[model samples]
Target: SQQGEEDPQALSIQEGENATMNCSYKTSINNLQWYRQNSGRGLVHLILIRSNEREKHSGRLRVTLDTSKKSSSLLITASRAADTASYFCATDTTQGGSEKLVFGKGTKLTVNP
Candidate 1:
């Protein structure tokens, strides 16, 4: 499957703690993107790293990509209650002339203050 699947359907943490999630895919991809969703709203793009890249960081969020292993991980350091949301990893597969993104089921993170 080209779709990415994230481990740990849900996570709970206290404020100022760290949260980590892992994702695994079954196909080759051009790039991987991580997104965050609040409640029932649409997803917001957090970061995107190409296949040629290994690791990328943005603010308190860090992402690591391993194309050879077809896996990736997302880490949030010093998590806050405001960071409680659903996180998803999406893969962009456009080799077949179909440019589409397949999203994972997502990991629901709950931050307790």
Candidate 2:
């Protein structure tokens, strides 16, 4: 399968803390994307790092990719209560014109005030 699996099915943290999640895939990929879903709302794209990239950061979010090992990690620093939601990692196969993304089960993050 081209899909990845993320560790820690659920996480709980206090406001202002940081959270980290790890994902591992079974096959080579073209790119990996991280998404955040709030409650019943649609998923919002957080970041996308290609297989060639090592690490990328966005504000309070940090993502690391290791293509050789087929693994990735996501870190959210200074998490707030509003950050409570589900985080998902999606993998895009390397084949050109393939826009399909296989998503992981997801990590449910709960931040307490």
Tens-place lDDT per residue, model 1, 13-96, is 999999999999989899999999999999999999999999999999999999999999999999999999999999998857
Question: How far out, in Å, is residue 72 in model 2?
Answer: 0.5
Residues 10-51, candidate 2, lDDT per residue (tens digit)?
Answer: 999999999999889888888999999999999999999998
Q: Scored by CA lDDT, what does every candidate get?
A: 0.95, 0.92
Highest-lDDT candidate: 1
Which segments of candidate 1 are over 4 A away from where they belong?
A: none
TM-score of each: 0.96, 0.93
Worst 10 residues of 1 by lDDT: 1-10
The pairs that clash in candidate 2 are: none
Give residue 65's error in model 1 in angstroms.
0.2
Model 2 gets an lDDT of 0.92
